[model samples]
Target: MDVLTAIRGRRSIRSFKGDEIEPEKIEVLKDALVWAPSAGNLQSRFFYFVYNDDVKRRLVGAALGQGFILEAPLVVVGCADIRRIAVRYRERGVYLYCIEDLACSIQNMMLAAYSEGLGSVWVGAFHENEVAGILEMPENHRPLAIVPVGYPDEDPVPPERVAHKDTVKEVF
Candidate 1:
């Protein structure tokens, strides 16, 4: 699917089919992240693919029983390696800017998934520290978001958006 079509088709799928998502497709989704524009080309984002059932359950627990996480066959975690940023800006460390970079990359991956006829949901309501520890990430790497991917079993309509007149701002 084209960019605009994917953008309009992508939805926060809460129900997934029992079929398994192929690793090749998962790689395709991840490759989008590698090409995502990063801040100063730091390339500090790290992705973790969680396919194990037990681990998925742990993640759901960390997410306070958001069962859909465990239901999906694959979970992609978007993380930012803060230590890399700290190398150049020592005092500043990873900072919020790095988080934004990772988050944007995750969104790119989500869009890629949609183009491939897959469904994904961006999960931000979760325990970050617990996820970092579960993923065996270093102290400087922070978990930004979790995206569950698969063939959606249910089709829920996207909610209507506010008119552009109310949302767009002009600062002249």
Candidate 2:
């Protein structure tokens, strides 16, 4: 699917078919992350793919028992290399830029997954320290999101959105 079409079609897939994602498609999702525009081109964001069922169960536990996480075939974790950010761009990099960089890259990967006929959900409600430990993450690398990806079994309708009038204000 095209970019705009993917953007409009993308939904938080809470139910998955548990089908294996093609290795080539997984590569595409990884590429999308590396190519995401990073603040100051620092590119401190990183990802870890979890395919093991046991690990997925641990992740589900860390994510407040979001059982659906264990049902997806793959989980892509967005993490930040804070040490790299600190050295490259200092305090602002540590506190702000790295977080934004992670979000951008994760969004890119999500869009890439959708384009490749895969489903994914961005999971932020997680126990960061627990996930970091479970993933064997470095002390400076913080887990930002846990995105479960797979073939969707359920078609979830888009949730309500705030109307433009209330959400957007035009000064121009």
Candidate 3:
């Protein structure tokens, strides 16, 4: 599917079929992460895929009872390596670009999954400390998003969107 098609069709999949994701699709998602734009090409973002059932359950707890996490066969945890950004661009980069970099990577992964006919949801409402603890993440890596990807069992109609004219303002 094209980028626009993917963007328009993608939905937050809260329910997923038990079917396993193909390794090829997983590789494409990984490539999407690596290829995503990052500040100064420093690539502060990191990702971890969780497949174990116990780990998925722990993640659901970390996500503050978002039990949908347990339904998917895989969860891609997006993280930001703030230390790397700080080394490259100091505190300002860490504060500004690190989170954005992580977010961009997640968007790319989500779109790529959609293009591959897989389903994914971008989950950011989780407790960061709890997630880090659950994943046993390194000290410098901060978790930003937990994306559960699989064959969608539920077809969610797109949520309402505000008209573009009202949402955007011209400065120049």
Candidate 3 lDDT tens digits, 1-172 = 7889988999999999999999998999999998989999999988989999999998998888999999999999999999999997998888889899998989999999988888999888889998999888899999999999999998998999999999999899
Clashing residue pairs for model 1:
none
For model 1, how does the per-residue alpha-carbon lDDT over 10-57 read when each residue is reduced to its tens digit?
889988988898879988987898888777788878889999998998
* Runs with alpha carbons beyond 4 Å of true place in candidate 3: none
lDDT against the true structure, per candidate, is 0.85, 0.92, 0.92
lDDT of 3 at 75: 97
* TM-score between model 3 and native: 0.97
Q: Using lDDT, give the best candidate's number.
A: 2
Extract clashing residue pairs from model 3.
none
- Candidate number of the best TM-score: 3
State the local distance difference test value for candidate 2. Answer: 0.92
Tell me the lDDT of model 3 at 133: 92
